[model samples]
Target: MMKRIALLWNVVKGDARVLWHALRQPERPVWLVPATALVALYALDPFNIAMPLAGVVDDGIIVPLLLHVMVRCLPAHMRRA
Candidate 1:
């Protein structure tokens, strides 16, 4: 169980690093910016802000999906194995 948590943490950290790099690259794919913005908006949506329990549930499911989509939008050169 601890190993699984550690592994998941590492994966999340790696994804975050890759996304940060994509944001910094001048030649980043055009889709990246909008995708990121959409994720941010959804994460902070009024509905989420208004209902704490539902917000937690909604974010638990949706945030990772949005992050995956953003990562998938990365250019081939930026993608890690």
Candidate 2:
């Protein structure tokens, strides 16, 4: 697991340019789709959905938004550097 995390980090650093370019595409939607899906799932669950709600908010919403902002705010050459 540690190795996987390290590998992911390296890949992200090396491919920052590509990743930023992909993210900058105007057609790409932000976290809205997943947020909507999570809301729907919560609504559909007859039992209490508090656990899933928390999970989605933390993992899905917060993490992605943070990553998106971080990527977008990075300097252009730094992305490739």
Candidate 3:
């Protein structure tokens, strides 16, 4: 129904606002994380480095590990928010 759609829209909007606020926190150093992660990921990529397990190592482990490091690099306060 229209009412259900409206409620869903409201919930999604609120969640977005919360995420926007979190991303804007002064102490977060937001851009630094992804930029560094990208560089690190590229350097450590198996194929780029001529490793034999290029696909599996890069996709299965390195990518996720880089993402986790990126998230961890964000300020604690921003993450808590």
Candidate 4:
């Protein structure tokens, strides 16, 4: 469990760094901001799609998957090791 937590923390930190860099750049990809906003909105569950019991499961799986995809969609230059 600790290992998983540490890994998650590392990934979050790395993604945050990449996003900060992307935000500071003049030529950031057009999709970056909208995609990030979508992920944030989905995470907030404002639409209440997770009303059903199964919906919670969907949120658990989908949110992180969306985040992973969003980070992956960043330009190679924006991504770091």
Using lDDT as the measure, which candidate wins?
Answer: 1
Model 2 residue 55 lDDT? 65
lDDT at 32, model 1: 85
Model 4, CA-based lDDT? 0.73
* Pairs in steric clash, model 2: none
Global lDDT of each model? 0.78, 0.52, 0.56, 0.73
Q: Give lDDT tens digits, candidate 4, residues 26-78.
A: 88999888887877777777455537566666665676667667779888877
Q: Write the per-residue lDDT of candidate 2 for residues 5-59, one digit (tens) a residue.
A: 6875665555444554645556445753454455446545544355776664455
lDDT of candidate 1 over 1-81, digit per residue (tens): 789758756766677778888888888888888888888898889997779899977886678667766777776788763
Q: lDDT of candidate 3 vs native?
A: 0.56
Off by over 4 Å in 1: 1-9
Worst 10 residues of 2 by lDDT: 59-68
